[model samples]
Target: MMIRDVKDMVKMYKLLIRFSIRSRMQYRFNFWTGSFIAAFIAFMEFALLAVILSRFGTIQGWSIAESAYLYSVLTLSKSIYRTFASDVHHLEQYLVSGNLDGLLLRPLPVLLVLMTQNVSIRFGELLLGFGMLAYSLGILAGKGQIELWSAIPLTLLISLNGALLLFGIALATAATGFWLTRISMLQNLTEDATHTAIRYPLTIFPGWLKGVLTIGLPVAFVNYMPALYIVRGEAGPWILALSAAASAAVVGAGALLWRTGMSRYQSTGS
Candidate 1:
């Protein structure tokens, strides 16, 4: 029965994704234009990092290419996260207008339904991120800093795990809308600010802030912690296993929060 239900949801998710794509394609110009703008913004971010490295040489002990690799890793993760679950991050809009009441009426899982809405592909980010990753890894490989054979697969795995980490963060943040209808401020601090901060080395920040990032939010697991071992070889392969475990743990915690929040839910109408 459980397996059957899982299959049911998968079928439903695919059908819904098709509907979403069709709805957006009704405005093909907007779709293409928005995609280009998103990709351009992502490119500019890496360009800024590259410019900083050109002037300063390296971020602490990280080389320019390594820093670029770090940026690409996070970008790929974010692109993956947003591609499959764009509405999860924009949940506040639904909560504010009481649209969630409609979703609650559906037989399927509300989270899965929300994940399918606004299914943006984020091709720009993916293209640029892979381009940067390849370019940076090429440089690192040439210098014998990393072996392309192993680094390639591990980087892809880490990027996928990083996407889960971000989705969990966004899930927990959206669950807060159960009590507080307006969540933009909370999202800003948790998702926007923290994401920007992690683009650089965590050690560059103060002790308290670093602790907040590592413990309070744990976004560091999304990139920095794994990079320590993956790029610098500061530890053994155990870090990769730990990073994967951390993603699962965070997702479980987020699911717990979502259930608790649902129990306390009060619709604007009611």
Candidate 2:
């Protein structure tokens, strides 16, 4: 029965992907242009970071290469979340416009329907992220700071977990839409602040702020902890183990919050 259910999910996912692709293809030029602009903006952000590193030489004892690695992990996490779970990111639209009722009426699980409703054309950001990660890893490998064989697998694991962490945050933020009706300000503030904060090493922040990020938001577990393990190899075992645990905990909490919010949902009368 479990296998059958898995197969059914795969079939449904494929159908959803096909529908999303066809819909987006209707404006192929727009899709491609949007992708290009996103990639360009990401590149420019990194470029600006590189310029700063050139002047400052290091950030809280982390070199430019190390910081790049951190940036890449965060970028990949955000891109992955944006690509796969974009519906959650845009949940305010559904709630405010009454379109969420249509999703609730579907036979499929509401979360699954929301997730596969759209597959964003954000491949460009993913590609740029990969490039940055590879470049940083190469530099570190040459300096004997990391072993590519082990680090590659660890990076992949952390990246996946980090993506889940971001998705969980997005879920919690979107869940507020049930009560707030519109949550763009809250969502943007949370996402933008967290993203900006994680771009640099967490060591630079004050003790209280660091504690808040580590315990409250827990974005630190997504990149900073893993990056420390990767570059210095000092916290390998504990960081990796804790990252997996934190990811699971955050995602579970987010799911619970979402369910609670759904219980309170009062659809906008369409």
Candidate 3:
């Protein structure tokens, strides 16, 4: 049954991709323009980091180049997740119109269904962001900044961590629609908080604040902690262990939140 459900979810997404392509084609200019703007904004963020690093020499002992390397990995993860989970990321409309009824009729998990319903085809943006990160990582490697080859696995692990963490946050926000039909603000809040952690080294913050960001929210640990271990040598073996445990805990908790929300769900009036 689970396997079958997964297949159905894949099929649903294929259909949605077709539909979204057609829909987007109708407004090609807007789509392309929006894609360009988004890509530019993402790029500028890294540029800003570069500028700051040039003047300040280092951010809590993390050089500008090192920060860029970390940011690139974080951005890559975020852009990839956003591209695939665009629908789940913008689920308030489904809840508000009681459109979720249609999804519930399917055998697949509701979250998977939501994920497939909308896809971001901004491959241009994704490519550009990834390119910048790749270039940065190469520079870090050439400068003897990072140890041989471990960077790739570490980057992949943290990217997975960030994806799980963000998905959990989105799920929690979507769950809130059970009680409050409107959730645009909640989504914004989550994104804002996430970007904050992604943009800076977690160690720059105070100890208590760091604890909250690392554990309470767990966003910092996604990129910052791991990067520290690799880039700065501050990460002990125990810290690496804690990072994995923390990510798993968030995933488990987010699943529970979604399950609880589903039980309380009262479909919006049609």
Candidate 4:
């Protein structure tokens, strides 16, 4: 019975995702424009990096190529996370206006429905991310710094693991809305700023900030720790196992927080 129920949920999730895509396409201009703007923003961000790197040639021993690789990996992982859990990142809206009340009434889980909300694919981000990742890897491979065969697949593994790590962090942050009812500032610090920091090597950050990101949020496990082994070969393959472990632990803790918070939820009625 449990297996059957799980299968049903998967089927329903697919149907909801299709409904979401059609709903989004109903306004093709808006959807495409959003994609264009996202791509443009990514381009501009990279351009800023280029200008900085052109002057200094490197940041704390990280070349432009290596930095781009970090950005691309994180971007791809973020794309995956946002693709699935866009609404999970916006739980404050539900908590504020009581939209979550409607979700709770659904036969399916509230979290599952939330995952299906605003389910548009991030095409622009994906394109730029893939382009940068390929370009960076190509440069490294040319220099014989890394092997394309093993590196590509392993990087992909890390991307998937990174997505889970990101989702776990986002989930936990959003779960805090159950208590605080306002988590935008926290999200900006935890999700936005911390992610931006990892685009560069962690070595550049001050000790306190690094400690917060590494211990408090643990985003370091998503990209930096694994990248040490993948791109630079500075760590052993054990780093991958460590990252996988961190992802699972955080995800489990986030799920627990979400459940505990739900128990204390108070609905503001319509």
Please give the CA lDDT of all the candidate structures: 0.88, 0.87, 0.74, 0.90
Candidate 2 clash pair list: none
- How well does candidate 1 match the true structure in TM-score terms? 0.96
Q: Candidate 4's C-alpha lDDT?
A: 0.90
Please tell me which model should have the higher lDDT, number 1 or number 4. 4
Deviation (Å) of 74 in candidate 3: 1.7
Error of 2 at 176 (Å): 1.3
Clashing pairs in 1: none
Over all chains combined, what TM-score does candidate 3 have?
0.86
Candidate 1 weakest ten by summed lDDT: 261-270
Q: Please give the lDDT score for candidate 1.
A: 0.88
Models 1 onward score TM values of 0.96, 0.96, 0.86, 0.96
Residue-wise C-alpha lDDT for candidate 3, range 1-270, written one tens digit per residue = 999977876787788777876877788898888888888887887778788889998988877767876776677667767767778767778877888899899876787767766566766657765686678677778888776588777777777777667666667777777778788887777666666666788767889977777767777766777777776677665666677777678768877887888888788665
Q: What is the Cα-based TM-score of model 2? A: 0.96
CA lDDT, candidate 2, residue 230: 87
Superposition error at 161 for model 1 (Å): 0.3
Evaluate residue 188 in candidate 1 and report its C-alpha lDDT on the 0 to 100 scale: 97
Pitting candidate 3 against candidate 4, the one with the higher TM-score is 4
The better candidate by lDDT, 1 or 2, is: 1
Please list the residue runs of candidate 3 whose C-alpha ends up more than 4 Å from where it truly belongs after superposition: 1-26, 236-241
